[model samples]
Target: MADTPQANPQTARVLSVSELNRMARDILERNFPLFWVSGEISNMTRAASGHWYFSLKDSGAQVRCVMFRGRNSYLDWVPKEGDKVEARATVTLYEARGDFQLTIEFLQRAGLGALFEAFEKLKQKLQAEGLFDETRKRAIPAFPKQIGIVTSADAAALHDVLTTLRRRMPGIPVVIYPTPVQGKGAANLIANAIETASRRAECDVLIVCRGGGSIEDLWQFNEEIVARAIVNCSMPVISGVGHETDFTIADFAADRRAPTPTAAAEMASPNREALLNTLLQQQQSLQRSMSYKLNRYMQQLDFLARRLLSPAQQLTHKQESLAQLGTRLQNSMLQLLGRQQEKLLRLSLNLQHLNPNAVLNRGYALVQTRDGAIVRASSQIAAGDPVNLRFAEGSAEADIRSTAKPD
Candidate 1:
C-alpha cells in the first residue's frame, strides 16, 4: 500500500490516563466560567471533613457537584435532599476519578435570584437618596412612658413581646395596633397601623415586629411603604422582624433594630429590679447626707447654747455694773466737796489779814468829822466844828472844843 504512510514518531505523541484527565479538566474549566446553575439537590452528603458532595438534577439529567467547607460554611441554612437550589459553579473534571463534576463557590434558593436582584436595586436606589443616612436616625428614649406595638394580634411574636414587657416592667402601659403582617395588602395595613399610632401620639416608643419567616413571607417589611412609614413615624420606631440573620428595609429605616421580638420589648422597657436598686441607692445616699448635715447643725447649736446667757443672768450682770459706776460717782463728788472746803478756809484767813475791822480790834481808833470824814493826822482835825471817834465795838459823835498839836 505504497509503504502505507510510514508512522512519524515525532508527530504522534502518547498521553497517559492521568495526563489525559488533567488536559480534559483544564479544557472544561477554561471553557465553562463560573455561572449559576438551578436544580434540585439530590443524594446530598456532608463529609466528615465539612465538605459537601451532592448531585444537582433536573427533569432530564443530573450532574455531580462538590462544595468545599470554606465555601459552604458561610451559608445561613444547610442544604438538604430535594431542596431546590442555585449554585454558582465552574465545570471541571476530577483528575483522580476521571469524572466530570462542578466546583460550587456560592449557593442560594433557586427563585431567590429575582428577589435578590429587586432587593439590591431598591437598596441602591434608597441608599443613593440618603434614606439610609445615619444622620437621619433618631435615638431611642431611655425611659419610654408608653410603648405601642404594630403587629398581628394573634401572632406568636406579640405574645413573646408582651411576655417580655410584663416580666421586665409591669408598670409600663402597652398599646396594640393590630394588623396583618403578611399576605396580600399586608404592607398597606402595616403602614396604616404605623400612621395611626403616629397620629394618636400615645406611645413614646413604637415597636413594629413579626416573627421569622422566609423572604417571601416577610416581604411586607421590605416594601417601600412600610419603610417610609417607619421613617416618618413621630415616635422612635424599633423594627424586630425575622431571625437574626434576616434583614428587611424597615430595619434600616427604624430608629433602632432588635434581633427578636423579645429583644425589642427589652429595649423598650427598663428592668424593674434595676430601677429599684438605683432608687434604693439614691435614697441611702440622701439619708446619709441629711444625717451628716443634721449632726453638724446640732453640734453648732450646742456650742451656741454654751455661750448664750439667760435673760435673768444678763439683768444681774447689768445691775452689778450700774452699782460699781454709782459708787465711783459718789466718791468723786465727796472728794470735790472736801477740796472746796479747804480752799474756802484759806480764802477766809487771807480776808482776815487784810480786814480794817481787825486793825480796829487791835486797839487802833478811826477819827472822823461830823460829816463822817476820817482824819488821819491831828492837823486834819484843827479848828473842826464837830468830830467823831470810832472804836472796834462802837462809834461816838462829839464837838471839837479846841485844836491841839501832839508830839
Candidate 2:
C-alpha cells in the first residue's frame, strides 16, 4: 500500500500485482477522510450504467473522480465541461487497474456558495424586518404614467430597459437616475440614486436594475444600503439586476422582482396595443351605460306624458260631472213637487167629503125650539107651543101640539 520499490530477492518478501493493487487501495482509503476538491471539470463521461467519470484539474495538477448512479441520482445538478466545481470525495486506488482516483459523494458549483451565503443572510435579515412581506410590498403600477430607471448609464441593462419600454409603450416618459453599477463604492452610488429617484417622485414607478454578470460584478445590488434604499423608495421598485438564475438582496427588497432588465421594463410599462383594446372596451361600456340611462329617462317621459292632461280636457271632464249633478238635482226636485201635489189633492178630496153642505145635499135637516129652543120631543113642544125648523138650505118656524112616537 506504500508503493515501496521492489527489494533484492536475497532477503525481501514479494507481492503479486493483485496484492499490490489491493494494499494500495486500502492504504489510500485509510490515509484520506472525505475532503473537498475544487477544480474545473474535464473529460467528463457518463457510462450506459449511469456512472459518471471525470477529471478535476487546475493548471498545476489533475485527479480522476467517479460518481456512481446511486450517489449522483440524488444530485439536483450535474457538472459540465469547463465548469468550476467542488467535489466531496474520498481518495482511493481502483483495485483492478491500480489507478488512484476519488469516489465523489457530492458536487457543487464553485463561486456560488459564498455569494449564496451572503444572499441568504441579507435576505433573512431584511425579511425579518418585513421588507419582503407581501403586505409591505407596493403594487406594481398597471400602467405607469412615467417610469424612473436607476442604473448605470453605460450599462447594457439601461439600453435593454429603454428598448423594452419603447417597444411596449412609446409615449410613456422615462427618467434615468444614472449610477455606477459595479466596482468600488458602486453600491453606495446605487443607493443614492434610488433615494434621489424617490425624492424626486417624478415617475409613477421605479426600476432598479443592471445587466447579468458574475457574482462580483453584480455585488452592488446585494449591498445592505442598496436593499434598504429599495425598501425606502417612495414608488414601487422593480429589481432586474441579474439573469433569471441569479438573485440578490435588492430583488427580495424590491416591491416587485423581475428576472432581467427587459422584463423589468415590461413589468413597469403597459402595452399600447393592449391598452387600446382595453380603452375600446371601456368606451363601449360607457356607451352602454349612457344608452341604458337614456332609455330609462325616455320611459319616464312616456309615463309622464300619459299622466299629463291638457287644460281644456281637464276642464271638460269637470264640467261634464257638474252637468250630470245638476240634471240629477232637477229630476229630484220635479219628483218631490209631484209627490206633494198628489198628497194635497188627496187631502182636499177628504175635506170636501166631510163638508156640512155635502151632508145637507144628502137630505139632512136641523130643528130648533121657539124662543131659541129646538122642539123634537112631544113633551117639549107642548110646553113650548112654538118651534123653529131649518132645512139643509133654509130655516123655518113651527109649533107642535103633540109628540109623535116612532119605533
Q: What lDDT score is found at residue 260 in candidate 1?
A: 87
Colliding residue pairs in candidate 2:
368-374, 369-373, 369-374, 370-387
Give the best candidate by lDDT.
1
State in Å the error of residue 210, model 2: 2.4
TM-score, every prediction? 0.57, 0.61
Cα lDDT tens digits for candidate 1, 103-165: 999888889988988887877878888878889988888888999999999999999999999
Error of 2 at 284 (Å): 3.5
lDDT of each candidate versus the true structure? 0.91, 0.88
Among all windows of 10 consecutive residues in model 1, the one with the lowest summed lDDT is: 376-385
TM-score of 2: 0.61
